[model samples]
Every structure is written in structure tokens, then in C-alpha cells.
Target chain A: MIHEYLIQLLTIISIYAIAVTSLNLTMGFTGLINLGHMVFFGIGAYASALLTLNGVPWYFAMLIAGILASVLGIAIAAITARLKGDYLAMVTLGLVFIAIAVSRNWISLTRGALGLPGVPDIIRNNFYYMVLCMSIAGICIFIFYKLINSQTGRVFQAIRDDETAAAVLGKNTYFYKIISMAVSTFFAAIAGSLLVHHINFIDPTIFDLEFLVVIVTILVAGGLASIKGSVISVFALLALSEAMRFVLVSPALIGPVREMMFEVILILILLFKPKGIFGKVDV
Target chain B: MLSLNNICKSFGGVKAVDRCSFKTEENEITSLIGPNGAGKTTIFNIISGLTNPDSGTIRLLNKDITGMPAYKIAQSGISRTFQLTKVFRNVTVKDNLLIAKNTSEAEMKKMLESVYLHKPLDAIASELSYGQQRLLEIARALLKPHALLMLDEPTAGVNPRVRQELKLILKNLKKQGKTILLIEHDMDFVMDISDKVIVMNEGKVLREGKPKDIVKDKKVLEAYLGK
Candidate 1:
């Protein structure tokens, strides 16, 4: 039982690594604030879950899911291209709300928050190792790394530093923003799918404010714009959350205490070393 | 070829710019000289599309293009440097060159060397001496090899040697057929290098002529240079 749980924990960590790493690509390199990151994750999870549940082959379902999620990312980016700084953050926040709302209302397709279940493990027959392998090797993980180290990545950073200067040099910043947003969203979808299979369920609540808070914490604590920082943040925070439950040893360990704990930690860090563990840009 | 016609601009009851009209030909260094509040920089903003004139037409290559966004205007072949040289402070100089974002490594090196900064490519832009920073601004403007370039007070706070170097580069840019528009307070430097000189007073052109003629014009002497 311990071995199974350990495998499950590693698998979860791997999925978070991919998702947060992709987030780092935008937040770190492009200086984009994407509060609606979970929407992309949910989109990818559902696209694959629904298609395969209807008898589509696993690989094809995943492919379709990735494409759909990436396209959704592009759409959000294009819509928010003109917005900058705080306005951009607000726009993404609205996206999260709207996505959850759609998931709640679209019962015929998303089952209207009754929740999607029985999503087959990405490679089910092989059990723990199978799921673990899928989670680690998912397109999201592979592509996130690839995209960040490219020439495109450098341009994104340049734009982040001084967008006006970048624009004058012939960079179509609007188009590039869309491209970066799409790529980040595609990975979010992959992470979502991993969650769906592990729990054998999906619901609008999976992308709630609390979930967003966790993601933001991971992104911040790990470091903004640093892939390495984000990955470490995911592992550290997930372990902290999961281990804290067992350590309680008293109650089911419910409630608002986590937020308070995080709040205190956030304040302490901001007062002391606010740049995050590995942030090279502004804190 | 850069030209402005009937350009009038007002800001909150103050006429920062009023009834301005001017023309600049290709491959020539043209300087706009005026008193501090006489609207020299404001005119630069209008011509560079940083601000739209309340009423006027801006033409580049003889095509009317008024009220275009600053970056778009830049991409359409007019590049500008700020009065306060805006460098990417956080990045290294090489990275600064890299941030131009579309240059070949060859072109970047060529540009840096043109401003004699190729050797210190690893230095941070902000860490450079005041003169070096000024030169970097020009090199940055030259990085695009832009058809029409505007520089606001390029020598205002620069050291003498650095100022001389900048004048040399502007002369070379003109020789290379890149039209250069500049706002300068140094009459000697402006007159020495300019193929054409424009004298402005109270947001209007006082006279436009050859350097000698502009200096000799009676009104030009009284309104500017204290001659």
C-alpha cells in the first residue's frame, strides 16, 4: 500500500512539474500573468477523457486534447493581447471564472458538474508504473522544456523587459503573446488530464479559487520566470500539503489553517527574501 | 524624406506646439534648435508619432501618415532615442544588442563597433560612462539602420569627446543616406554638422537656411544663439 501511495505521489508531482514549468515559461520569460492557467488544464483533461470514454484510441484522444487546449490558449492570448500589467492579470482571472461557469452549465457534454468519471488511466493495463510513465513523458512535460530553451524564448524575455523596444524592432508582440499563451495552456491541459485519470473524475470545482491559489503559490514560492524554481516549488508545496495531513495525527485536518500558514510564510518571505528561491527577474 | 505640415498641438491650455511646419530631405543632418519650452522635444514627439498633433499631416517618403502609434511608426522606418537614453538596464550590453531581437550577430557586432562599443560588449548599459551611454543610444538608433531617425538632445549632458564622437557618427549616417533629425542646444556643433539648420522661437519656425545664412539672419541671432 505504501509503494502504491508513493507511486501515486510521484506521479502527481510529475504532473505538477509539467504544469508549473509551462507556467514559468510565460510568467518568467514573457512576463505574462496567467491566473486562468487551470482552464487550459481542464480543457485538455476533458478533451482526452470524453473522447476516450467514447471509444477513441488513447493516443488520438490525447492528440486531439492537446490541440484543443493549445488553441484555447491562443484564443485567450489574442483576446488579452492589448492588455498589460494588472489589466492582463484581471483578464486571466475572468477567464478562469468563465471557464468554470461553462463547465457547470454544459451538462450534455461535461455532464454539468455531476462530474466526469471512469477516465481510463493513460496507460491503464500496466498500473502504477504505467501511469507514472505517462505523467512524466506527457507531451506537456517534453514540450514545455523544448519551448523554453528556443530562440522564441529569448524574444519573449526581451518583450517582457521592454515591450515598446521589442515592438519597434519588428517583433509582432500581439502574435507572439498569443503563441506563448497557447503553448502554456497546452501544458495546463496535460496536467489536468493526469488529475482526471488519477481520481477517475472531473468537475468544475477542480479549477476553483483554492486550486488557483495553490498554483499561484507554487509559481511564486518557486520563483517567477524560473523553470527550475517552479518545479522545486511544486514538489516542495505538494509534499508539505500532503505530509502535513499525516502529521496532524489528530483530526481529518480540514480547513482554513493552510491559508493562514501560507499567508504568514508569504509575509515572512516578502519581508526578507522576496525574489523567490531562484527568481532572476523582479520579485 | 520626412515632412510635417500645419502641425498644432496643445496640452491642457498650454500650447506645447503651435503651427509647426518643416521638411527634411534624405541623407542630410537637420537640427531643430530652440529655447527650453519652445517645443523642440514636443515637435520631435509629433514627428516620431509618440504624440498626435491636434491638426496636421506627417509625411515620410512623401506618404501622409499622421497619428500612427509610436512603435508602428518606428517599424515603418522612423526610429528614435529618448532625451534620457533608455537602455535595458537589467541586461548586459550584449544582451541589450540581442534584445534588438531581430539583428544578425554580424549586424549587432557591426553596430557596436560603429559606436566603438564592440569591445565592452559584456558591460552593462547602465554601468557605462555618461558619454558611452550616449554613444550606445546612437548605436541603438543606428542598429535598425532606419530611414528616418530622431534624436532628442543627443549631446545635452554628454562629455566633450563623446559629443564629438556622436557628431561624427551622425555625419556618417547622413553620408549613408539615413535622414537624421535632432534637437540640440549646442549651436556650434549643430551649425558645424548640419546641412540645413532650422531655428525655432515660441513654437514656430523662425528661419530655415544654410548654417552660415541661419547664423547671419538678424531674427535668428536675436531669437537664438544670443549672437
Candidate 2:
């Protein structure tokens, strides 16, 4: 039984490994301070959940989620492209709050706050062997890392280094940023879909600031712009949070103590290592 | 060959570039110099498509290129370095070269050596001293096959000896048949290399002439140097 739980835990962690790696691509390599990146995560989750509840096939829901997230990403890029520096960050922060509001209030499409449940699993009762689902997840994560280190990858880093310099060198940074966000959103959406499918239920509450915090923790605590750091950080955080669940064993410990512990650890990690465990030191 | 015809630009109430017309023929090193506020850099920006002219025509080999995006302008065989030494500070010198370059390995190495940044290929661009950074910018431009290269204040903050080193690189560029437009504050560098000098003051071309004539031009002296 513990072994099965461990597999489930590892599988859950594999989803985050994909999500945070993509975030690392954007925030680390592109040097875009995208605090609202969780909007993409929520978009993916809600997209898959809503589609599946409406009787769409599970695979189609995942496919549509990537497209919707990509369009949303381009829309965000269009809005934030002309704004520079801290202004861009502020615009994205506003976007995060707006996304939460929409997901909570948009009753027609998202079923509002009631949430969606009964999402059919990919293999359903035959999740015993579990070979295909986990293999696909691992392959996707591997490719995500490979792409970030390619020649196109260096161009993204160059844009972060000096935008105008990149522009003059024939790189369209607006195009690059949009593409980066889209790619990041694509993976984030996939993670969300996988999550919804695994849990068989999801709602607006699942896409809250709390989830955003965990994603950011994985990215920042793992290291800035480091793919390996992102994957490592997620597992470390999941392990820490799981350990905290048992460690904080006072039966009287009440009202989201796990969350409080996660918050405390996040503060401590950021304080001691702002660049992250494997992140480059900011100079 | 690159040409600008009747280009005019104004910032609010002030005219920055007014009815300016100039052409850089193939392979000649041209110079633009003037007193403070003469709009030399503004002309550079307009010619290179960094800023659009309110009214004008820009052509390369008589192909109209007015108001094209800056990247397209670069891809069309025109590239530039800023007056303030625009370079990627975090990236290495070789990466800086690759940023503009779309050439093979052998040509790239030759381009690097031409500007004297070849030896420090692995050094962070900013870690190279002030003069080396200037050369790095110029070297960055050379990596591309540009017909017209505009440099704004390429040697602005460099010491004299290194400025002289930059001068040799400029001469080599001239020898290689690359048309050059340079904005310089140093009178000696300007006079030594210019095939034709265009002098401006208060956003208009005050005089255009041979280097010796520009040196002796009375209005050029009075407006620029307070003589």
C-alpha cells in the first residue's frame, strides 16, 4: 500500500516537474518576471475539466487545452509586449487577479464555483500497469529540457540579457516572448490536464493563489533559469510538504497548517538563496 | 549605396533633423560631425530605421526601405553600433558575434580578428575594458555582410591609444569596401579618415566638404568649439 502511494506521489510530482520546467524557460531564460503565469496553469485545468464534463474525449480535452492556453498566452504577450520593465510585471499581476475572478464568476462556461467532478481516467480501471501515462510524462519532460538548451534557447537567454541588443540582431523579442509564453503555457496546461484526469475532480479553488505559490516555489527554490533545478525543486518541495504533514502531528494543529509550513519554508529558502539551489547568481 | 532624401523629423517644438539629404556611396567612409544639438545621432537613427522620419525617403541601392522595422533593416545588409557602445554585457564575445552573424565558421573568425576582439572570444563582453568593448561592438557589426554600417560615438569614452586602435579597424573596414557612417566627437579621428565630411548645427547641414575645408570652415568652428 505504501509503495502504491509512493508511485502516486511520484506521478503527481512528475506533473509538476513538467510545469515548473516550462516556467523556468520563461522566467529564467527569458528574464520575464511573470507572476501571473499560474493563469495558464488554471486555464489548462479549467479547460480540460470543463471539456471532459461536457462529454468530450479525454485526449481531445488535453489537445484543446494547449490551444486555448497558447491563444491566451499570445493575448497576454500582445498586452504586455509594449510595456517595459516593472510595468510589464504589473500588467501580468493584474492578469492573475482577473483570471481568478473569471474562473470564480463565469458560471456559463466553467460551472462557476461548484466545480467539476467525475473526470474519467485515461485508462480507467486498468491503471494497474500504468506504463503509457507515466512514460508519456517522462518523455515530455525530457524534450522540454532539451529544447531549452538548443540554439533557439540561447536566443531567449540573449533577449533576457539585452532586449534592444537582441532586437537589433534580428530577433523579434515580442515574437520571442509570445512564443516562450505559449510554449510554457502549453506544458503548464498539459500538467493541469494530467492533474484533472488523475484526481477526477477540479474547481476554481484548485486554481487559487495557493497553487500559484507552489509553482513559484518550485521554480524559484529550484533555481532561476535552470531546468534541472526546477525538476529537483518540485520533488524537494513535495517531499518537504509531505514530511511536514506527518511532522506537524499535534491533533490540535488546525486550519491549514500544511500551508503555513509551506509558506514558512518558502520564506526561508528565498531569504537564504534568492537565486535558488542551482540558479545563477544575479550580478 | 544608401541614400536619404528630404528627411525631416521634429521633437515637439524643436526640429531634430530637417530636410536632410545625404548618400553614402559603396565603400567610402563618410563622417557626420557638428556642434552639440546638431542632430547627427538623430540622422543616424532615421537612416538606420531606429526612428521613423516624419517625412523622407530612404533607399539602399535605390530600393526604398523607409520605415522598415529595425530588425528587417539589419537583415537587409545594414547594421550599426550605438554611440554608447551597445553590446550584450552578460554574453561572451563569441556569442555577441553570433548575434549579428549569419556566416560560416571561417568568415566569422576573420571578422573577429578584424576588430581585435578575436583573442578574447570567451570573455564576457562587458569584462573587456572600455576600448575592447568598443571594438567588440564594431566587431559585432563586421560579422554581418552589411553594405552600410552606421556607428554612433564608437570611440566616445575610450582612451587615446585605444581610439587609435579603433581607427585602424575603421581603416581596414574602408579597405574592405564597406560604406561607413560615423559620428565622432574627436576632431583628429574625423579629419584623418573621412572621404567627405558633413557638418551640422541646430539640426541642419551647416556645411559639407573635404576634411581640410571642414577644419577651416568658420561657422563650423564658431558653433561647435566656441571659437
Predicted structure with the largest DockQ when compared to the true one: 2
10 residues in a row with least lDDT, candidate 2 chain A: A125-134
Cand. 2 Cα-lDDT = 0.78
**What would the C-alpha RMSD of candidate 2 be, to one decimal place?**
2.7
In candidate 2, which residue pairs clash?
Answer: B83-B152
Check candidate 1 and list the clashing pairs: A28-A225, A41-A188, A107-A112
Q: Residue-wise lDDT of candidate 2 within A1-283, one digit each (tens)?
A: 3477676777788777878887787788888777777788778888898888888998899989988998988888877887766887788778788887887898888777887778778766324424444675677778766776566666777788777767767677788888888888887788888888888887777657787777887788888777778877888888877775567767467337767766776787788888789886341
Q: Distance (Å) between predicted and true CA of B223, model 2?
A: 1.2
DockQ metric for all predictions: 0.38, 0.50
| Alpha-carbon shift of residue A199 in model 1 (angstroms) | 1.9
Candidate 1 lDDT (Cα, 0 to 1):
0.76
Docking class of 1: acceptable
Candidate 2 colliding pairs, count = 1
**Tens-digit lDDT track of model 1 for B71-168:** 67777788788787766554557666665545676777788777766456778666787778777767777776468888888877888877777777
DockQ, prediction 2: 0.50
The alpha-carbon lDDT assigned to residue A184 of candidate 2 equals 83
